[model samples]
Target: METRLLEPMESLISAFVLITFLQTALGAQEFYRQPTHESAVQGSSIVLRCIIKNRDGTVQWTHGGFGLGTERNLPGYDRYTMIGNTNSIDVDGNSIEEYSLKIDNLQLIDDTNYTCQVSPGDSDEGIISNMATVTVLVPPSPPILSGKVTIPVTLEKPTNVTCDALNGKPKAQITWKKDDVRIMENTYELTTTQPDGKRVDTRGIVTITAQPSDAGKKIECGAWNMALKEGEPLWTQATLDVQYAPKLTLTHSNPDRTIREVDEVKFTCSGEANPFQITWRWYRNGELQADVNGYQYTIPRITRDFHGQIIRCEAENSVGTTAVEHSLNILYGPKFKGDPAHVSVDQGERAELVCEAEGNPTAEITWRRQNKYSVLHTGSIYVIPSVREGMFGVYTCTATVLGFHEISRDIYVTENGPPQITSDATQYASIGDRAMIQCLSISSPKPIFVWSRNSQPIDYASSGRFSAPEEGLPFGGKSSLQILDVQEEDFGIYNCTVINTKGSATLMIKLEKSEEVQMAVIIGSAVGGVAVIFIIVIACIIYYKCRHSDNESYAETDSNTEIKKRDKNESPSEMTKSTLMDQWRQDYNYRYSAEFDDVDAKVGNTSGQYVCYDTERYGTMPTNHTNGHLYGEGVDDLGPLNRFENSYSTGYIPSTFRSPSRTDFTSGRVSANELASGRTSVNDFTSGRVSATDFTSGRVSTTDFSGRASADLVEPFRLPTADNTTSKLATNV
Candidate 1:
């Protein structure tokens, strides 16, 4: 009874659970409350939501055809998240919400469909919501147009152009526009994925043939997409360079290309091309002339080598090259060959005058007389069968050309004449002066002359006084006889005789002397010599008086002190200016002052004769003169020094003082050092204290100071001691 009751209860319970499962299964549903199709830019966040009103079901999300995550947890995707049950929150708080798919860091690959699903707790079947698209848009990159940097495009040869847009989502579309006008030409496109795994690449290409009118026209490529917010396409443009070979021409400024030899030539090459600044090259007879590079080529000097040559000009550019050619014709002016400007012929002789020249058009030759206006000959040679006196005028030979000056040669006909004197026959010359007698004559075969004195022949070389023309055959000959340093003996007739093979001529000259003028010159020279002696005696007398007075004006107080001053009105102090000789004179006593004049004597006079006295020699003093006091009074007795009778020596100067350069006597001044030997005069005052000590020690003889010891000379005397010490007067000379 218990087993039967349990079986019936189990059947009722199973039938009731089956009916509830069928009802839940039939009621399950899923749908996206947010947009079923949505869009978002790359690098943004998005959501795919499923809001199901069935309170007993669970929700899930999927990307494309793959599951995203369930309500519990996501397995492989970290950027994907699901929110459901009590943890679910409102997105914008305006619609029913459930577990929704939230994608962060949106990229280009995310531009696909997303779905949401809902199922009852006990059902195996779940309803999938319509896919919601997240279009992660990417603004297309600025379009890039690529082609050759320098393209030679033209209608004759068409070319292709390509443009590309990179890193854009949903592959951009490319179009072409030429010169702002849309082109309906076929465009090819290719699509590719970017390395980022996020964006797409799009490329477009088109073929075009540029026409002449299309040069400088702009061709543009535009990349566009639906996601563009500004509603304008990304574009790039390029300018077309229509190409064509240059139109070549060879031109010249001159109407005639024909030129003279040694004349300059210039040829210019002109060209027209789509691209300018084309290089130009020059060729001569197919050979390149590397020196020329400019648009205008010049030939500084054309020569015979360039005659009949072909000149070509080639203009080249990226498009193509063109060439032009010109033929040359070179002409030259007439040039004389082996022809002289002037020719001569003797009377009654045969004469042949020839003129020759070569030119492009052979020069025409003619002959005529210079004064007469008629032609003499018509060929290269102008012949005179027998030259006569009537043919003595000038004749001309002319060579002519169209573009040059006429060339000419002259033949001067002349006659020969014998020698004949043309000037007067008489000439006169003075004695004791040079004389010349000349014979002037005219001759043809030249002439020779002979000269004679008093009818005797004169040999010019032995006479050493005649000169004539040197030519063996002299024309307009001159013959002359000359007497140089003339004396009474040369006072005679001179004859000049000129002779040639044809004839001879003669001329004569007469010379004489005056004795009165010679006697007057002798008397004048004797008078001049006597006047010179009288002037000398007068100057000496004046000098002696002046010097005697100067001596009496000075006085000596003591040897140690300087020369005492004199009365200012009488004389100036001798010590005002010092010299080597003045210092020495301070120690001596003499009739005439040993003191030299400080003022130089007047020159160009006989005053120099009075400056010849030698003060250091021994001689007789003039009888009446002496120092102001007695000679022996107040003297410094250092030794047995002799008193000089003639302190002013007019005698031979010693070798020691005989310097050829001495001018002190004429200058009226003396050097104290000159009172001693020349070696001492130059070095004594400059030889330091050693020489001073030697002088004071009396080792220097009187001859050292006097320049020489005379027959009445004194022994060496001690120089006066200065404060009992030797004088330090000497130093380096």
Candidate 2:
């Protein structure tokens, strides 16, 4: 408005000022400009920008009023970038007016107020930019729900339920629900931030008191955050548990609990319980029977031992234990009263057997053969009209009752017979040889045997040189008689008699000597006759003597009478008879020669006789030097010769003949009294009063024989008579 003098320098200054005003309005210095709030996920890149209208301004960045970077210096900065220098260009190819403070990885520490300040080169005063907030968005992870998880839980106890949310940028919220209904209770909550300050977590807990009505109900927990997606809340659930004791109810099909032996019996125990795990056990008569895992118990076979006994079943678990009992009434089968041993019956005889038994309920009796199922009879008494040999077997008597096992008894039947002889009735044997006669027979209970010869019994005590039957036989049904050495007397009738209670039988046997025995007797007689003749000749030549006339006959008569009396008493065995027979022969020969000499020679003379001396009696004739003739003296006594002469030769001879002495021949006047005093008797030799050596070599003194006479007379022999001859000479010769 002032029109003053117009100079050229002033006009140039006004046009230049107008151009400066236009440039100032077009480009001005400003710090960074951004939205009031910014959002980014953690671990993502973000920028805090400061925009300027002039590039000549100096820019600096600050976090919460603390310096982060300047135009020329960025002190102790990491993961942070400053961009847009003087030579930088934007997307539109113009100078870039934005100074960016960039963090490469966004974290929780990056989520705060950031400030940008700028001072233009022309002005020294700085201008501070508006504050901007960065938010790190994070979503919660899967939740954890914890509590008691089993069903039918124990009652009246405090059980805690909890829900938790983890790793959320903003703090999470947790809640509880029951059966889809929200729950309001004294819930405790806990919140926590991570050590790096990047995430936040929340946990919530609630306690529930369990009741019977809460059984089988569902409880749930939920976790949520602002950063969560739609319809994606974290959830977990649990159900309530209840507990109780067992209640038992037993069941059986039997209305009265009555059973029979061998019948199948079953029992069951079942009831309601809180926890269904149950174990069952069975007991009988107050004793444990079996353990059953389930609710049922069974017995396949019941016996009389279990009758009137109680059976109990118990069910047990962790909650409680309960039991139930059932009493059994049993009917038993038949049992034997008494058992009989095997029976023996004769063939073709009738048999009757009775089987006695006892039972609770009377049993039905039946009879059958063993291994043959066909029934033979239907009564306790079994009878056979006529028992045959084939009917001898085992017969079973079975007693049976309804609902019980069968009991059986077996009876065996056998047969018996009477004794019968089956051996020959005649036996032949040679004399002086062994012979046997066996009487075999068959009978039941065995038969007793007795052997008899003629009529006398032949037993161990009576038999001589023969063996009778022993008390028992080698073979069961037989007996034997063994004649060890048979004689003429043993050749007679033999009877083997067997007796039993049933009957008696006799087998007659004739024991005959063989023909060879008769021939042997004839031959022995002929040989003995020749021997006797030779003995008589030798005796006649040895003892020819003069005879005493009247005394000889009288002496012989007295000796013969004495021997006859002595022979009546003593009886000798066959061995003793043989010994006496040999002595009889010698005595007979001597006595006969003396008698022949008495017929020929006169008394005290050797003429008209055989002139033989007694050389056999005396060892030799003693020389008679005074008479110029041989005379007999010093005679050894041949003991007991004439006394036993006929006793052995025939049957038994009496003591008929006296022992002749040397004095009887030397002195004819000697009487029988003196001869008897010095003579040996037959009893002395046979009865062992004198030894055989004393008989054979006895000597009589010359003084006794000569009777103190002068040695002038020859002794006269005491002659023997016809009665003194040996009976063997009378018979065999």
Candidate 3:
């Protein structure tokens, strides 16, 4: 079949018409119906309906993607009974065209999309209905949450927590909070299942074990669901408190009472309390030591200064306080003194007694006499009526204070008298001889005598041959004592003691012996005898040996003198025989007598003419009157011959001379004529000569030898005038 092609617009219009025509020819029509979109809660009812445009068609309904017909109905539509047509509708009023649906007890799952369809005749295809989507909308009332209705209900016991909520759209979840934290499930019991088939929200009861910390805490319950706009909450709170009391105790502070200077004693007060503070205080001598909080008190070291002080310790807390006390007692020792206990005083004189004592609190003093009489009290001085022997015993002074007592030294009083002593021998005596010392002390009442040998007292019985004189020997109006035969043992101090009613006195006796006076007589006699014998022997030997030698040298000197005399033309008259003789005598006397005898004799003969004569007769002779005249011209007429005679008479005579007449001047006195003439007399010549017989007999002879010419004599008799008139005359001749 050849068909004509149509234009694009015509073809589109034709296709539309054909489709529409086909729809009309097939007897298919769309049902234009409004689905009754009614919303219900989880446990409410709902209904949906369809409206048909064609009168002769079949109608159907569906939910979500599942078909909905009479055999398989929609959810919650099981009990639906259709009230409209089941096939094509009659135009005028047949019961075959209208379509409708019903649902009861809707749930959350029941809300969905619905569809309605229509078929016009039996042999025609059905038509797709216009999409009149009927959506199930719910009006956000208070939610009946599923878990709240059918879920488990849980609660903790003894906790006042409400399992309820408010102001939620669908439903809100509810829970309990402790310390702002969720409670554990294990702490609560729960119940589930509701009376209706729909699920309900559950509310849990919160159980709490209250503690001190649980006071003033908050508990809560709430509900929520997906349909609710916000969660609903219920809240509650309470306050907690606890009560208690405190306990107390005490302890003492100081254990040792011996406190140092400025030392503190501490007392401690302690206790256990909930809300209280502790305090401390102290008391001393019933008075407060300080204000409160004074746990310690200090006391300086006590002296006599602080003897009766009292101290205490106190302990306290907020509740109350108590006290303990102690006392201080200082101890001191005793002291005593006495000055000049023993003193000396004259008879019938007054004496003093001094006593003192030192003690704590000033000791009380008392004085008593030796005779038990009270003398003084509480002072340092005591006096006696009269110082006598009866008052010579110990006087005691006692001091008592503060239950302590002390006694002073004993005081003794005495009187004074004269010293008594005597001597059996004089003050001077010979050495190695016996002497005596006697001593006696006389006091007013006849004091007792004590004898001392040296410094120590002597026992008369033990000392051999020592004797003491009778006591109370009256002499010179005083008593005396004599000690006999005192030896060197009595040389040292000897003391005499005397006692009387008044007092006592002491005296010392000393003795000494002389040595020089005893030896004077014996020394003088012995010295005189020895000297006389020594001189006699010396003179005898000198005369015997030197007599001849002296004569020969004299003769040789004369001869040599003549030779020298001729050379000088000097005369023999110028030579002096007396000078020669004196020289010879000095040499002989010194050599012989000084060597043999230890005696010295000084010659006082200044004329140098004195001869040492063995016999006293020769010693007085004028041997060289003519030589004296020559050499001693114009000199004094008196010669050594006169001096020799005077010395012999004065006991300077040699031992060889024994007759008493030897002491007399045997030389004849110069006559007045010889004095006037200045010449030797005939008697002087006789006195100058000595006999051989006298020498041989070892005695000085008094025989006259005036006419005898001996070889020993020089011959010339050239006498010079006393005035040197002859020397002038010879020079002139």
Candidate 4:
């Protein structure tokens, strides 16, 4: 098959060589012109040309050894036809014959080499010309891509992505690119024969190691062939979804400001991640705090201990994890770093006191006298140029931090080394228990301690309860007040004064109750308070029910007192007014004073004078008396004779009641108000609704209303109170 396919190509080359040699050996002009190549797209028309000296013999065209006769159209290839019969003049005055092939509706099968053959009678042998190639290009389909639509971060492996171009003539050449840049490594192409066996398909593959930076990038699969236009290739692309883990960066708040105790600080974590649903974790000094699904971490109260601590923030997504760290810088208050300084000097000499302190932002030092808070010097050292008798006192040194706490220490400037109380001597104890009060004094000579209570020395022998114990120590001495069977009187401000040859020192020791005793006292007080409140509430409820009860009690008949009754002519209010007016008139200028003096005459002579001899169920009621006058009344007791029974009517004289004449023997005048009326006001004297003017006008207000009364001959009215305590009114003038 190979030999048969090459026979036409070999014969065409031999004919081309013979024509060239004959022209060169004979030194004669060429008879034929070589055909130039012709190109066209598939399904389009193309023309192939052949030129010679003259039109003297028959001309024909052949493709690959198959001949097309002198007829214009070919046998099976209707698209192939011969053209050109006239001559086209050259630079020389020579005639030329041309035979060109015209193909219409060109297809891929028409792509082959063609040559021309001529026969000029018998004298000139038949000749075949050199071959001219006819190329027909068919464009392949647009590139189709498959594999790895999204790539994840893979450190141990690589991703394989593929692209294909199907059934292209001169099989398409395929390649891969990332975001318009070509990829060279781990890339290859494949070619497969198509079904018709005339064309092939091409496939391109690229293996890559995915990185976090490749997220949201583009991967391009391009196909190029002879059918494609120059500088333009068939391409397809996909935006890469590279699922990568997070790379975390941490930021904090208040970079310029200091973080003191009770200050707040905030930290935030952020990074680029493929899956945005990431989790964050916070750590301090390598200790994990908590796992947070968010990015912010807050320290509500930053302390000084966190100054050198390391803060870490970690972030994680579906793929991996990352972290960042920062060291904290915290600020705090100043403090005295070393032992308290002491300076000793003579009456007229120089001395210095140095104060050493430490703090964040550094501490400032100042010096002042003890008990005198004014700053005397500003520095870490205090120098006294001259010491005098007036300067023989304790000095104080203070270290201060701006906007923070300050500390102070005292420096003694004594003429001789004196005793100074150092430790707190306050103590706590319970009654019936033993107690010990301690006092530590610093001095060269041993200190002698004396415990006293309220400026009086304790009589140990008299009470047999107190004793003074002393101890000698390397620095100074320790003294304690010991009490056996401590009583309540022992808990007080007890003075512990230490005396030495150098100087004297005093300490006030307050003995207080212990926690258990104090708590017991509190509980006892609470229980007692509840009991008292319960008793008071019960008493009030009983009083309310008894005072408001409808049934009234009766009082003993007072035969030595005057009797009064309700008057039919007076309303309840006017009766109240007449009662008060009668007191004002009968006492000094009171007109009713004479009426009570001669009660027998008035009852015998006056018909409508008064009557109240009947004693019934309503004999007692609460009464009210203010400023020597009765005012209040009881509940409804209305009737024809004593409508105000069990009320102020007990003290009133009735105007409608016909007093019995001398024949009607009546008992001595009875003071019904004093004997039967009840009293319940917190104050002894209670006022009523009637004002001073109403009492004077005899038109007083009672029962929440106003009524007129007779001022000349008035009755004494008594008022009742809610508590119903018996109250008395004077019947004698």
Candidate 5:
């Protein structure tokens, strides 16, 4: 506007200056500019556009503000030119500017502000212009997790929830929750850089524990970038499930059972929870009875009361426990009764009494004998013998059942009457005769008979002939006393005692001799024969004195001589008679010779008298010759002699003599000298010349010469021998 200071060098300088000004203004517009975006994802390509504003101007490019042009203007700007476009200008390089800035990849420091400008002249005239700011931007991508999203969660267990955003522009924010409740907050973590130059975004772990109530509950994991909004949530959920089983138990009231007497009963119990199997057991006393799978129990026929009884049941499964119980009261009764009480025995004997009883347990039997001896037994019969008065007392048989009950009975034994006695002999007998005494008894009870003599029991052979018929018996006979020849020794009382239910008896006897009267007659006749012979001798002496009186003295001497001679002859006969008479007197002691003082009166005359006189009147003769002659004779003649001699010859005679006269005559007063010297021959006596003188000769006179002989004194006679006059005399006497 002032047109100021134009010179020759001014006028020419003025036109040059105007042209310099136009060139300066045009070159100032060709500088490079920085991009607007600063940051980029690590592996992505980026474009950094550095814009230049001068069109129709030479342009150059460089890094970190280094120039690519010199002071001298050159065509090297073609290397920095836009395609098909030379120097053309637009404001701030909106159009037709040299836009020559470029970047193949972006980095963090590339975010700084950059300037683009141009230089007007050579050497010291270059300048720079205003810069454009670049800022790199990145958006959030889907996050990835390292561990499981739907996790198996347990109570009281610590767990980690991880969210990794690979190569994220800004690190991500992570959280954890359970059922939408917040558990942990944004705990962002930066992981180490990747090989592709990108970074990892890591989140913190969420620690939590679950309880029993937390079983089957949900737990959650959540992630956010704020770059990724809430509507599209980064949260994951898992359900928690828990598993277990329950426990079981069982119970009972009575564990053991005992019973007394008669009562009723029941049993029961319960079981605990589980998948349980149960069983029940019942016991009587201490013994096991029944087992069942159910709870209720009952026992019928309960006869005994259960004393302190118990019953129990049990339940069991995978787990364990126990429960309460139920019990009962029971009773029972005694089982059996006793058998009958009795005794068995033979008809007339004693026996035993046995009592028996039986029960659940065996019963006891008590036996009492006569209320005295006592015995006990389980079961048996009692026995005894001889049913007598002693066995007649009380016998009790009692039985006790179960030691609690009893029954008894009384028994008695009885027998019949006493025994009897029978004998075989009459009431009386002579001494030395046989007699029998026997005992026979009859009773219901058999008797024992004891046979005794003189109060002492008799042995079988004590009596010469005594014997026992058989052993003692009831109907059978017993001992017998056979007194063979009863004597005064056997005269004592005899007893056959029958000992039985009844009592005893005896028989008495006396023994004596027969023929006392016959003995007396024999004594009288012997004394009478001596007296008659004496009378005859005295009478003959008187008659001779009367006839010789003239030679009185001679007559007296002669008569005296005759008397002496007669005395001599008669004395032998008289002495024999006297000896026999004395012997009879000594043996019998009976007074009978006084009645036979008359000899003729005792033996009267008969023709038999002469036979009696020769033998009987010569009683003092020797008998030695007679025995010798008789022994030599025939036995027929000896028979009558032996019979007659033995009949009257009391065996006191010597064996050498044949007659009793030998004993009587040898003791006679007759001298042996007189018998030898005297001569008294009276012969021719065998002729049939019957004269009074012959009949009445010598000492032969009788009480009546023809009177018959006494029937008691006379007996038939025979001569034993011619020399046997002595024995014949003995018989006649």
Candidate 6:
């Protein structure tokens, strides 16, 4: 075998070896390149390269010993060309020449043996290059289905199917599949060549052992070749005709109808079977029942617990077993909807309670008072047409089904009481953010909600930015007024009233700008604060500078003393208005700056200086700035003042208290608009918080107001001490 292979190789190359010896002897020329074996897909192009060096010779091409004349384009073959590189490349002072064959639009017929013949120096002796065999790839045809088109099998038996792909240049790769899934197990392939000895064919066979579960499924064979489109193969398919055991379907006597307690229901298992005899089995919720081999099972007295059960029936034959299930949604006993209710209404108004239940059979309802045997009312709703004082007690509502259990819910009746609020009285949101003022109150019989702003009723039902929704709570009434988009006009006091059959209670809820706005204001104030402080410092310095000169002119000499003496007869009511600050500016400065509250002004150490406390901190204060008497509430927790042994004036009482501005006692803080609201009184300074005590101009409480001190403006003391002096404050109060 080896000698036979070497004989062919030696014969093809014998001429080349002889030419090499002759060329060495003559010292004439050499072969630089030789044609190489190649494979090309049909319909593409290919090149068989040949080159020679120092060639003073002619080159010719051959196909399987047939001569092909050396021409630019081959004779009789349009796709064949004998091309040469006439412009030779120099190699070590020797020119290298190329005489290569180029083939385009290749076909299977082009696959053959090729050779390049070179004759050196016009000698008759020819030198044959090594033989180069070319292969043209041809794709196989689409696969053909054969042998069982529909393979039939059962659990106990198996079957086979075959597919073939014929006439491929290179043998095709055959693959087996079942229902699009590649089947490798029990699948085999065979390959064979056609008589022509060029093209081959392949066949794939796959075995099927299908169960009842896989009946009516498809099987397939795929043929793949490198010459075909990428990732796509030709396919042939078959289906499975599987024979198995009986298939069962279950049906109940009550189809789409309610089966109540004590009602009879029968379930039947029916199916088609391959075998003559079929064994039946029944299971309830996966637990096998005692009776087997019965096609129908009957439940004579089905109970409520039987509802929502899965009853399955199985049919078995010699081949296999199949099962089906029926789910029971039988309606049964009655059950109450919610827990016992406690309803309350106002005296003499109709009171009612609804008792709801669900059951297959309609439930009967009745109402009765506790410890009283008589049935009060029937039906789902128990109504008390007119409830009086004595009617406030517990009533029982009973729901019953004809043959099942009876359920009861209690209704505790009571007269509604006055509503009391429990939610926050102040709600805040920024501009363009939602603001909800919720008023949650506790009373009996759900209450109604009413909203008002600045003594005017607010109608939330009208399609507007403000909306109030109705709410009903158990023994309470809850309501919220939603400000959809908070604007400048939205921030204010909102009166929320919770009313029922009982008395109504109104809560004062203030919706103001959120803390974000305060933070922005603080930042803005801080930015301008430095410049304002510089200006004030400069003004104070200049005032002191001028005051020093003025003191020299009006120093308590004999002439100034006589002027003071002239004013000595001026009574305590004698007053002089400010020269610089108009009433508005004075009021604005008092509200915003509140310099009297400046604990930093501790010259602050002394007691008699009345406190101007922050209402936000203390929670309450007097809005009435009349008579310049400051009243504060909950002042027992004064911080820095506690460090001093100060006696608060418990004696002072505000007379003729009035709020000239809308900033009343209820809204203790000053609004931005109120600062420039043109509201100003000469001595209208706000003290601290005041109670509802309307002092009828008599002597007020002698008890000294502790932290209630915001220093009085009219410091008309008998001894004529300064503004912050303890003795002067005590005397003036």
Off by over 4 Å in 2: 1-28, 31-35, 64-66, 70-79, 82-96, 148-158, 184-188, 192-200, 213-218, 238-733
TM-score for each predicted model, relative to the true structure:
0.28, 0.28, 0.19, 0.28, 0.24, 0.31
- Judge candidate 6 against the unseen true structure and give its global Cα lDDT, from 0 to 1: 0.60
Q: Name the lDDT value of residue 209 in candidate 3.
A: 42
Error of 2 at 142 (Å): 2.8
Write the residue-wise lDDT of candidate 1 on 580-642 in tens digits.
233343322121121322111100101111111121221101110111111111211111112
Better of 2 and 3 by lDDT: 2
- State which candidate has the highest TM-score: 6
TM-score of 6: 0.31
- Model 6 residue runs over 4 Å out of place are 1-245, 249-323, 329-333, 340-352, 359-362, 383-393, 402-405, 412-418, 422-440, 444-472, 477-504, 507-733
Tens-digit lDDT track of model 2 for 90-155 = 554434566778776787778788877776566435677788888887777777776446434446
Candidate scoring better on lDDT of 2 and 5: 2
lDDT of each: 0.54, 0.57, 0.42, 0.59, 0.40, 0.60
Give the 10-residue window scoring lowest on summed lDDT in candidate 5.
599-608
List residue ranges in candidate 3 displaced over 4 A. 1-28, 70-77, 85-96, 119-125, 129-733
Candidate 4 segments exceeding 4 Å error: 1-31, 87-95, 120-122, 147-156, 195-198, 241-733
| Tens-place lDDT digits, model 6, residues 659-678 | 12212322323211111122
For residues 651-679, what per-residue lDDT tens digits would candidate 4 score against the true structure? 34332222222111122222112111233
Weakest 10 consecutive residues of candidate 1 by summed lDDT: 600-609
Instruction: Please state every model's RMSD to the true fold in angstroms.
Output: 40.5, 44.6, 55.7, 38.0, 59.6, 26.4
lDDT of 3 at 199: 43
- 1-733 per-residue lDDT for model 5 (tens digits): 2356433456887888896776565554344454453455433444445455433333443435755443223235331322223365456333454343443345544444554445453423444555555443333345555434344333354434455554444555656566777764533455555454534455545544546787656666555553454556466566654322222233323336444344334455554443345444434444556554455555544443343454444433332324343343432323333432323223447566555544334455666653345463334566665543234333556656553556555443223433334332223335767755534333224556677766778777655567656442212234545667767666645655656544444333222233234756777876786787688567545533432332233333453543333333222243444443444333221111111111110111111111111112211111111131111112112122233355332112211122222123212232222212221111111121222232123322222111111111112222222222121122111
Model 3 lDDT per residue over 342-419, tens place = 444554578777777665556777776533555544476777667543443345676676654454544434334333
Deviation in Å, model 5, residue 275 alpha carbon:
24
Error of 2 at 723 (Å): 99
Per-residue lDDT value at 76 in model 3: 50
TM-score for candidate 2, residues paired by index: 0.28
Better by TM-score, candidate 6 or 4: 6
| Candidate numbers sorted by TM-score from highest down | 6, 4, 1, 2, 5, 3
